[model samples]
Target chain A: MSARDRILGAIRESLGSTPRDTAAIAAEAAALLADPDAIRPELAGPSLTESFAAKAWGLGTTLDTVADMAEVPAAVSRYLAQYGLGPGLAMQQAPELTGLDWSALAPHDTVAPDEPVALGLARHGIAESGSLVIHSAPDNPILLGFLPLHHILVLERRRMLPHLEDYAALLGREDGIPRNAILITGPSGTTDIEGSYVRGAHGPGFLHVILVGDEE
Target chain B: MSAPAPQAGFKARAAAAIADPTLKIAIDRTTGTAERKRAAAVAAFSEFEAARARGKAIKDHVIAHLDHYLETFERNATAAGAKVHWAASDAEACAIVVRICREADAKLVTRSKSMLGEEIGLPHALADAGIERAETDLAEHIIQLAGERPSHIVWPAMHRTREQVAELFAEGHHPPPTAFDPATMVQSARHELRTKFLSADVGISGANFLVADTGATCTVTNEGNAELTTTPPRVHIVTAGIEKLVPSTAHAFALLRLLVRSATGGELTQYTTFHCGPKRPGDADGPEEMHIVLVDNGRSRMLKDEFREMLRCIRCGACMNHCVVYRQIGGHAYGGVYPGPMGAVLTPVLAGLERSRDLPSACTMNGRCAEVCPVQIPLPTLLRAWRGRSWRERLEPSGLRYGIGLWAAVARRPRLYRFASGAGVRLLRRLGKGGWISRLPLAGGWTGSRDFPKPAGRTFMELYRAEQSGKGGPS
Candidate 1:
């Protein structure tokens, strides 16, 4: 027998069922897939932007609020200046970012191995964990998130969701799930060396979020 | 050389751990920090207990109908262009991975930390097949450099000191740094691993949760090495246990909430990525081919018996962090891929009770493991179950069996037990000096570690009887 057959057979034997109820199994799977009865925490008081910023800040993520998309370049430039960095920023060719006038900054399409900065657009921001949801696409490359010393994420405040369940709900509405959807919470950090936390281990050392639109 | 054979028994291994001051300090510092962080994170969430309960329910539901969910996962994954392979044992799993790598013509392989991968000895398997593999997790990299197995599940190199890590890097890497600054060491590793990630033909990672709803394999990591390991290579392979399957993304998130908080005390890992399959036509970058290797190394058998609750483990490492015995001895003393309370129960189930007979007995039955377990696994109950099984099968040492048997026989008769206890106490008083027994027959295990406190002058029964009789105001 094939490994799959044998393994399933062993499971059947353990469950003590022969010719299990196919209808019940189908119904259960359908129920689980349709809508989740997930126990989500009550996150009501703070507005989505407030919760997102507070939670993100708590995770060591810096943020800047922009009233419109046009201000993103200035925000990025200012963040870079604060860190004593300049000019060359690797970014994806996403339409959301490409239309902006980045004449003052050198934006490269490809990230070098030791690139100092990269910018990506987030599909959604989860308020529960203060994470940015970035879907992989032709325009938004996945490497921009992991290959740079500093990562700047542009998130529309209106796209912020209250919980991870909401993000799942949003995906349920999509035509098809993206090949890769990463929920990045904070800058890369590790406590592996004698339990000391050092940021920027094999990923961006710093994560800056550009939250567009005024708070409700 | 091959790793030294496991110390004779849990006692011997634990004794050695107690003697190593450095190991003790390392274990204390690491577990203490993890415990504090977890407490703070869990406290911040008002609904943590409810969330934990939901996590348990979801896992239990999935495990009960595992065949259906796994089938769904395979179908959805295949639909999404991922090839799913089933392995009934570790060898088969390793063989499947090796075959895939060979077919891909992979030479250099980058790996993220996976306890399941360690259990299957994937690195050794790949090395024997002439495939070069580099561990990307900082702690795992250190362990790989030292040619040692991980001492802790989450913190693989928790047993290593800063100086030890610096020395290991100096020996392993070209042109090591001059100082032992942790931040510098991290940067050095990051610089070294970047080339490996960029140039590797294949990347291998382990999934923390596999979503059947979307056929996505998810990995959570703080260092983001998993993202690098999965993103850069042409082919990405996920080697995960079959038990990682969850019914939906919502369920995965519920467990993820508990996993990050319980493991490292973070609200969420730096990255919780869901890779549905290979890159799509419109995607700019990702693996062109993806493979999910579902390993069932002794887990199917675990599903059959009273010990099935062991499957509920999320690998949070909380059980070990709060365990008294594990806190003292560290993971190496457990002598298995997993360690601590979870290892004590799981190693026996996977490796057999005869080889791991001392593991269950090593616990103090403090129940802290169960209390802190995110999935609410009744760890103390499981440990006791293993102890009962060991006793029934006579897997325990002959001396222990004889000692327990003698005590059982004497305790069955109240008068004889009283007489024997009284006589023993008097004899102990005679032998004891300064109210401490320096040595005793058949108790070298106790005396070897520290002096045993002498018994009181009279047994509890004697004192109680005297008090009941109002004799001499009960001494």
Candidate 2:
């Protein structure tokens, strides 16, 4: 027998000497998967956006709120000016982003090895953990999230979920699991040296999120 | 040539570890901060206990039905374009990875921190296969450069001080760093590993948990190196233990909730990523191929034994952080891939009682490790079980066995027990000076490090009889 059969056989033997009901086991697995016995942590604060913002700030992420997507360019410019960053952005090729005119800012299609700033869109914002969920697509290269010194994510307030489980449930019910579904909670950090917290070890050192519009 | 055998056993290594001032300071500082942060983070969440219970329940269900779930996972993963391989031993696991790398014509590889990878000795195997691999996690990179194993599961180089790290960077980096600080050193590493990340032919990562429902492997990392490691490389190979399987994404998240809080005292790591398979059609950039290697390596045997509860471990390292013995001696003393309370129990089971007999006896049975365990694994009970097995199998020293046997003999007869105890107390009193014994016969292990308190000249039975006579309460 192959290693697979041997391992499975060993596991079956360990479980019991009696024969297993394969059909019953499969049904149980399907039932468990459909409704997982997962406990969702209660969201703090009065509203989802407040909770998300609180969590984001606690994890070393800077946040900006705009009235609408139209004002995103001005907000991006202001944030750059506040941090003394240039206008050149390695932006994702998403419709929401491409629809916005970028004449003032020089937006590139690819992320360079030492890209200073990159812009991407978040599919959902988790309030409990202050995390942004990103689903990879043809337009959304995974490198755009990793290669930049500063990551500016555009999250719509309407897409806010109360907990990570909420987003997970949505994914389970979705058409399929994306090639990469990442939940980014904060800027990359490490305490490897003397247990001291340092930001930007190998990914974005600074994560800036623009929460576009308020909850309807 | 094979590496030289360690001079002694766990006791000797622990003794040496306790005396190292650098390891002492590093462990003290790190464990103190980690304990405090974990307590606060756990307190911040109200559903932590519920989450932990749910997590354990899921693991129990999955492990009990592992054969079914493994088959299901294999089917789903295969459907999603992922090749799933099973290895009964560490060598088999490593060979599978090497074969994949060879098939991909891999010249260079980048790796994210995976204790399972260390367990399989992937680095040496890759070297033997003539593939150059880079350790991308900061602590892993430091230990890699220093030619050492990870001291702690979470903080791989917890035993190394900053000055030592700077020296490693000085020797490891091309143009040595001009300055030395956490940020500067991190930036220097980032600059160096970025090239390896972009150029490596394959990336090998360890799964934090594998969802059987979707056949997705989840990996959590604070540095985001795992993202780069898995994404940019042409072939992504996940080295995971079979025990990492969870029923679904929901179950994975529930366990993740407990894992991050207990591991780093954080709500979540910076990157909680789920990689299903290779890059899908029209995906701009991801690995062209993906493979999942499920390694057993003695875990299957553990399922039938009393140590089954140990499989619930999420590798949070919370047990070690809270363990009194672990904080003192640190991870290196355990002399295994895993360390601390979990290591003390697991090392003996995986490596066998003959090789790791001293590990089970290393614990004080304070039960703090069990209390802080998110999955509620009774670590002290497990350690005691190992001790029981060791004694029953005659794996312990004959001298210790004889001593226990003599005590048992005396205790079985109450009259002899009292007589022997009284004589022993009187002898100890006579030998002691200033109410303390600096050393005792046949107890060099105890007195070698610290002073032992002397017994009072009277036994408890004598004292009780004299008190009853003086009070006129008994004839």
Candidate 3:
């Protein structure tokens, strides 16, 4: 017998059940996804954006809250100049980011092995833990999130959710899940060496989120 | 012929660890910081207890219906272009991975830290198969270079001092680091690993959770090594246990919330990625092929018995962090891939009660592990259960059995208990001149290290009875 058959056989033997009812089990599993009953924490703060910003900053993520998406390129330019990093960026081809005319800084679509800076747009910002939810797509290559030394992500304030469960519920309702759905809470870090915190272990050493808001 | 004695030799190993002052300092500092951080994080989360309950409920449901969830996961993952393989044991799991690598013509493999990988002996398998591999996680890389097993689950090099890491880097790195600082060491590793990430044929990682509904394998990592390991290679393989299945993404996230909080005292890790399968047609950069190998490796046997609760572990390292005994002796003394209170209970079951009997005795039953456990595993109860099993099977030393037997005999009769206890107290007080006994028979374990405290002239029952009678004559 195949490993799968043997393994399933063992499980069935342990459970003391004959062959399981696949259709019934499938329906039950679907029901679980449709209406999740997992208890979520009651977030204390009134504003998700503020809570997100606070938590993000606590995770060592620097940010610039722009009045609108139109000002992102300039804000990103100023931030890059402040950090003394080069103007070159491996920016995602998403429409929201593509519409912005980044005249002051260089932008490309691919992330090189030693990409100094990469720009991607976060699909959602989790307020509970200060995380950015990014999904891989045609426009946004997954490497853009990992290869850069500095990853500058734009999370529109409207995309903010109260908790991780909210975003997960949204995912549950969606027809198609991305090949990769990632939640990045902070700049990559490790306390492996004598328990000392070192940022940028393998991923981006610095993560700066541009918290874009509605136009005034 | 009888098999070799089950190597549950925790006492001798713990003694060696205790003798090494440097190891003590490393373990104390690392676990102390983790404990403090976890305490503060748990305090900040108002619903931590509720979350723990929910986490336990989710795990309980999944484990009970593991076969159904696994089948569902297999179907959904296959739909997403992933080939799911089942392994009944470690060798089979390693063999499947090796076969996949060979089929892919893999030469260099970049691997993220996976405790399951360690358990299945992946490094040795890869080497034996002639596949060059690089460990990308900083701590895993250090331990990999040092040719040492991971001491802690989350923090692989939790027992290594800074100087020791520097020594390893100096010996292992192509051109040793000029500066031995943590940041510099991390950067050096980053630089060294970047080439492997770019050039590797296959990348392997462990799943933190397998979402049955979406067929996604999720990995939680602070260093992003898992991300790097999974994304850039031509082929990506997730080596996970069959028990990693959860019903839905929501359930996975709920557990992830508890896992991160209990684990480094963080709100979340730097990267928590969910990959369903191979890269889509238009995806610019992800492995073209993805494989999920679900290894049973004795977990099936665990599910069939009283030790089934061990499957609820998410490998968060919380139990080890809160264990007082683990804090003192460190992970290496456990003499298993897993260590601490969880390991004490689990090692005996996996390795067999006879082989790892000493593990259950290593705990003082402080109940801290259970208190901090996100899944509410009742770790102390499980440890006691193993101890009971050991006792029943006569797996423990003859001396302990006889001593416990004698004590039970005296305590069974109230009158004899009182007489024996009174006599024992009087003898102890007499021997404990100047308030301490330098030596005692059948207790060399206690007195060999430090002086045993002198017992009071009266037993606690006698003092309680006197106080209850309102005499209070002891004073």
Candidate number with greatest DockQ: 2
The lowest-lDDT stretch of 10 consecutive residues in candidate 3 chain B is B1-10
Assess each model's interface with DockQ, reporting 2 decimals per model: 0.69, 0.73, 0.67
Report how far residue B286 has shifted in candidate 3, in Å. Answer: 0.6
lDDT of 2 by residue, A1-216 (tens): 999989988998898866678787666655554433335566766899998989999999999999899888887888788889999999999989999978788888989999999999999999988999998889999999999999999999999998776887799466578989999999999999988999999999999999999667
Question: What fraction of the native alpha-carbon contacts across the interface, defined at 8 angstroms, is recovered by model 2?
Answer: 0.86
The sequence of per-residue lDDT tens digits that candidate 2 reaches over residues B343-395 is 98888767788999888888888899999999999999998998888888998
Model 3: per-residue Cα lDDT over A4-73, one tens digit each: 8889888878877856676776565555444333355555466887778788889999989888899999
What TM-score does the predicted chain A of each candidate obtain versus native chain A?
0.91, 0.91, 0.89
User: Quick one: ranking by DockQ, best first?
Assistant: 2, 1, 3
In angstroms, give how far residue B474 of model 1 lies from its true place: 17
Task: DockQ winner between 1 and 2, please give it.
Answer: 2
Over 4 Å off in model 1, which ranges? A18-38, B1-3, B7-9, B433-435, B471-475
Model 3 segments beyond 4 Å from truth?
Answer: A18-38, A172-175, B1-8, B431-434, B465-475
For candidate 3, the TM-score is 0.94
Q: Write the per-residue lDDT of candidate 1 for residues B5-47, one digit (tens) a residue.
A: 5656666678888888898898998999999999998887778
